[model samples]
Target: MHPTDSRSLAGNVAQLEAGRQITVAREDGFEALKALLPPPSRRALVLIDPSYEIKSDYAKVTACLRDCLQRFATGTYAVWYPVIPRPEAHDLPRRLKTLANQSGKPWLHATLAIGQAPDRTTPGEPAPRPGLLASGMFVFNPPHTLKAALAPALVQMEAILGRGRGQGHQLEAGG
Candidate 1:
């Protein structure tokens, strides 16, 4: 996991336990990912979960993913992004799919919304839901079994986690 903030990455009043191996890097993750991209023939899974707190992170995520595909088009890149009311959030999935298409790769995109985006009455009105109500993951060059496997799981997640009328899950894929 590429955590942007050291504090969140270090947080442990509870002392987290881990089964899988982990290596901590203090530098920027995007630059690190660029340096690590293997050849197009190599098979690897890259999970990119950025905070998206900064406006530039939206642009950076796509740029970095595009750069990675250029280096390793066959690699599986799983990018997790928040689903907020912001235009950037809404546009990201579309951007990712375009990149995958350009690289001649398949992608599976899934979203899980636990809360609804509240109705806005006026243009200047602040969102009733301040934080993220939904989030999504776009997987480029996903495994053949992934879509079939995740479909049922997402349905279960929507049933279990849904809280409002618009709260649900969606899965879309393309080559």
Candidate 2:
């Protein structure tokens, strides 16, 4: 279920002709996440995409992922994070890595930059304004071939989506 109750978002989702079911949940993401329980035999994908407008969202994301890992350790989880200048943004990757180590889970982290950053020294923090300069996806329990499969695509995306200097991509994996 999509973790949003916005009428406009629900209306937009209704327009999608996806073959499978997609429910727009009318509740908090944490509540929806807690209620979900996939069977052990089946594989599931849990994607957490936050707007990161509030500083507290960074901690919330970590907490949400920890809960999901406890409930469904085998599921593939991907977290989409913006690359901004904030210290929270800078530390999220490391925090996720620490979590992975503690959980003994394999993880993959990939980033894409489409233009020059406002501050080179602080790449993780995106500007608090419009337009995204860079973004990253941290995946827990990624497939063995996921990195190989994505390397070329990341380069292609950099070329196609890049706007100015500092346009590039980085991919790293660890357990």
lDDT (10s digit) by residue, model 1, range 1-175: 4454655665642255641233345678899987777844376788888778888899999999988988887788999999987899889999999888888899999999887644766888765644577899999999999999999999899888777777888999999
Residue by residue across 115-160, what tens digits does model 2's lDDT show? 8635445567755543788999999999999999999999899989
Question: lDDT of candidate 2?
Answer: 0.85
Error of 1 at 92 (Å): 0.5
TM-score of each: 0.78, 0.80
Best candidate, lDDT: 2
Query: What is the C-alpha local distance difference test score of each model?
Result: 0.83, 0.85
Scored against the true structure, residue 163 in model 2 reaches a CA lDDT of 70
Off by over 4 Å in 1: 1-23, 39-41, 116-130
lDDT of 1 at 56: 88
Off by over 4 Å in 2: 1-21, 39-41, 117-130
